[model samples]
Target chain A: MPNADGYVRTGRGSPPVRTPTPRSRRRGVASAAALLVTAGTLAACGSDDGGASSLTWYTNPDAGGQAEIASRCTEEAGGAYTISTSVLPRESSQQREQLVRRLAAEDSSIDIISLDPPYIPEFAEAGFLAPVPDDVAERVTQDVVQSAIDGSTWNDQLVAVPFWANTQLLWYKKSVAEAAGLDMEEPVTWEQLVQAAEDQDTQIAAQGIRAEALTVWVNALIESAGGHIIEETADDPADIKLGLESDAASAAAEVMKSVSSVGGPAFTTAGEDANVTDFEEGDASFMVNWPFVWGRALGAVEAGTLDASVPDDYGWAQYPRVLEDEESRPPYGGINLVVGAYSENVEAAYAAAECIASPENQAYYFISNGNPASNSTVYDDPEVIDVFPQAPVILESLENAAPRPLTVYYSEVSGALQRIYHPATAVDPETGPRASELISSVLAGEQLL
Target chain B: MSTTTLPPTKKTEPVSAPRGGLSDRSKAERRLGWRLAGPAFVVMLAVTAYPILQAVYESLFSYRLTDPDNRSFTGLSNYWVILTDSLWWESIAVTVFITVVTVSVELVLGFGLAMVMAKALKSIRPVVRAAILIPYAVITVVSAFAWQFAFDINTGFVNSWFAWLPGVSADTDWFGDKWLSLLVICLAEIWKTTPFISLLLLAGLAQVPDVLQEAAQVDGATWWQRLWRVTIPNMKAAIMVALLFRSLDAFRVFDSIFIMTGGANGTESVSFLAYRQTIARLEIGLGSAVSVLLFIAVVLIAVGFIKGFKVDLSQARGE
Candidate 1:
């Protein structure tokens, strides 16, 4: 059993004891020293040149809009700084992971970060973000949507600058709405949409895939029912109080259960993109998605991939309500700008972030990239209205939307919720309690998810 | 003749150290051997042992990467939390299920493929082997995406192509149900890795002597009898090696599940759970605990294969 002996020896033997002759040992030590030197050099290579006037903005994947804005902000800086854009991964979670790892190492190359709203609290809590100067905070928050402002703030301080705000709208086909006799002019409830879908023999597409998108859907449902996912967040993880056991949670669960039946056959796996595809080519007549769906549909029509009649029949309204009498709070999403605390050029980065988020640049971003602007003033831009006909509804949704729970342990809470409330058809009255227990245990370090 | 054989057998006898220690020449040879292997040993320690030891150390603390201020020495509580959690056990069960099913299926399929490749015409052997190895050549992530798209209801033709079969329709969602999702994930794993198993088995098949089959046939044995009693017994080492490698590989299944379902509908593997904890949740302590446990499980599996199955790897290597 020499092979077994080899395995055991390798597993247990200390490497330092293996040196034999003095001459060879000396050579080995020298080589090891050389290797250490090389590793040190490699580690040192990760830092940038620390150019006094250069700032790097880590932006989420988009259609060159962030890069364009970087160039614009650089030009506007009047030689104060030159901003360069580096794209993060497409998925928000990947973006968070990359940024978190680099920030944990105190990497100074990241001067600016286009952060997702849900992760802003985590980054801010970690001290990975530079403090927002009082003047910068005031200017950035001015005229910004309330949800965006709320999303950008942590611990009662503006931790990040609100860049663009996104909210879902109830998109419906006019023909289907008329056929189901459902009025599209007013806000509708989830029950009404399900009923209409059932009556019309069509689908209501919502994000049910097990991802952050699902968390957004779950958060919106709970918020619309007037419940916060975390009733009280504490400095200690164990002290966090979850609102999942509340009546509002049950109501949200009930709505999810009801809606799942009309959410198409592949409802459990339908993400935003799948829902869009279903809406255009399949039986999905109603969907709750970001305003990008409009651009996608029009783009498809222009490319001759879709019939022009689809966009012609499109109608948008406020997000669906969980309860008939209460107003719906849509899910708030988008990018916010955070300057790295380790950045040598923090001031320049802040200035560039402000320029990138200006109403004029925001309007340009909205019109060009199909991302909504956080500044409410951008909605009134005539060119914006020309590009996105549902600009008013989007602005209203953004104003009324509720951002996901703000907490340092957001990923754990969201992961737990996504695990328990998934495959929406399985959600029942008891689902909320189960999810609450899981989240509580996870937060307390008593459970794994 | 007896004296000549005695001298040769004495010459073959294992060398024993002199009264107390190795002779000077033997010591010098040993030193030379160590010096030759020194660099590789150091490289392995730096790359493998250091990180694993770091994980073991980190597993003793309650640390979240995002909250450096609150890190505390929790001792074995992280291990306790994971050991008592249902999600951990459920993921273990899922991982074991995938490993068992995929490895067993791939073994039988790979054996069949090996037989085909081994018995194919000499002129066309390369073509057959190349065709069979194509899936193995494709990257795992790319293959996972291809399989995911194939099973996706919106973008896939699988539902439409199989609509004629009972219970499968254009509306069939492969990733919607736990069992169905696991089935798809296992299918992807088996498809991408069976070629590797087959290639290994093909080497094993080539090592089996043709004379034994002919001799068995000459002795009035049936084809099945020859295969069972002669071919299989002679290739037992090969089979064991193939099973051991494939089982270990299958146990760490992550890429397909990550790409296809994102571990939805209870398809989470232990590796996926570790990733979710460490990368997604940023709980370094908890994730390291998961990793240490996974490492232990892998070692246990390897040990089991070696001890319980008496898999003599030396023999497999033709020593």
Candidate 2:
């Protein structure tokens, strides 16, 4: 029998060995040609003419502040480099996922990245970031708040340029504070806030949701109690030590439990935005939130969604204390700039990053975008003060704030902490030891989170 | 048609011919079949088998996406770690609970919907079907978000609307407790996917011969009796198929739980756990192990449905 391809079967129940026919050979050639065409098309799609002067900055989603800075810095470069902004996802975890995946693949198109502080250590440890030159580092770090500087450093090296810094403040209703007889001039403890909320027949709004916000609140509480979430860091994941099973951790847990009791009925589901809404309209009188709450309130008032008297009664203070004698270490957050290691225009990227993080640009970004500047000088800017009446308190909070635990295994540690200490009302004295074990085991690869 | 060109097998050589071996003409047909299906087979392998095989290969190592260079062979320790952990078991229990509840409830509700659609007046059948399918057509994530917003304490109307009910108030947090969160997630899943089950069951309902039901009616059988004796027995294959697909889908639930609670308050499914390990934590090895386990679980569920129900797909297709 002859097949369609002109191969002949010599006999039954036996495989035939024959020379390839012209038609069969033509089919092979056709397939090979098709393969070549596909390969060529894909290769063409992969390459781009993004020249040495073109830089792509991967930025976390903001209200056009980063894009404005990119354009300003591009003009200042004067043909050295033209910076273009690529907006990443809104969530920090998603941004890290995007940049990390690209950097892992050695994608040179990622010239500059706006990285969250918590993930900076991971990127630096993985050698995904280019080393910050001493001159650039010195210029960017000068006059920057210590917390931002600390957040940007890994292994004692300044791995990222501090762009903007963020910290939580104790936002309280002035009427509630006065009615409870709590001194608005002094720093209050979590104990005091819980007491005042109970006395005023109101609620305390804190982020107890089992997400990164929960991790931030937990870290701030522990740090304010004079302990680090990660007591010691090591190259080996197994050797790292956690500070959860300590007196400070117990105190932090105690404060969390007390505050959660006074937390509104939806406390466990409340994130920063939810807390802001609660503070605006609900029974929540005291909230620990980012500086955006003030901006949000004023914007709501201006938009006619909120009464103007609400903004007049808004009061801002430093983050609540965990202990009477110790100063509160508010949660530090914000974006920092890093140059991708694979970027061909490394020098240009660094220049662009430094230009973007300059005090003047930082002040502009602060005033325009409502993001706090990392440079202390920006807090003293008249426009900044005029825009953010809480500028001084924000600066103070940023100075004393503590970044989340710096570890290459940050996700694992934070995941464990969030899991074990969530729904603040469920947190107990045993939570500290349990979280320590979970973090240690997860880091050591002996357990799953 | 081409078999006419093939040489005939000899009847005298029956002893030499292997019992299961194909004759010349059938062998030729199979060769042609392979030639025709070769591209599809290779494409399926490339798109599906390659990644699953890759996952299995990577599951043997201690790999992190960020620190790829430090990956080392660890055999099956990742699986061992997961199997031993309480968290994995808790997530598994949650997944099973969701699967059982959602599939069972959907089976009943979907049957009701299928009956309505199947027996509706012909003029209104399309409208009824389309309206029923609107939830199914909406993206799962969008539906999940809508459901979350509807139940959210701060922004949701559920609290206020149900304020007069027991344990309901202006401050009721639907996502605050483990069971409550799972309840909301299940509600979202059921609302979004019941239409799919009903559609499948409707097709099954069509396959039940009308004459049999008419005969049962003429024999003075009640509607309930006729349904159990004729309708259900005839549509067994369709029901089995619907159950299989829905159970497998519900077992792998990720989007609703992810959007609603972010796996918080102990609502994490196995798929969500895998996502967290892979994307969030970057634990490639552990995540792959979880994925491989989930794949096995899905296969087992499919096999169980097929075997337990004795479903003949050919019969389901009305062959």
Output the number of the TM-score-best candidate: 1
- DockQ for every model, please: 0.36, 0.31
Cα lDDT, all candidates: 0.88, 0.88
lDDT of 2 by residue, A227-252 (tens): 99999999999899889999999999
TM-score, predicted candidate 1 vs. hidden true structure:
0.91
Candidate 2, residue A425: Cα displacement in angstroms equals: 0.5
Backbone clashes in model 2, listed as residue pairs: none
The parts of candidate 2 lying over 4 Å away from their true place are: A1-52, B1-32
lDDT score of residue B108 within candidate 2:
97
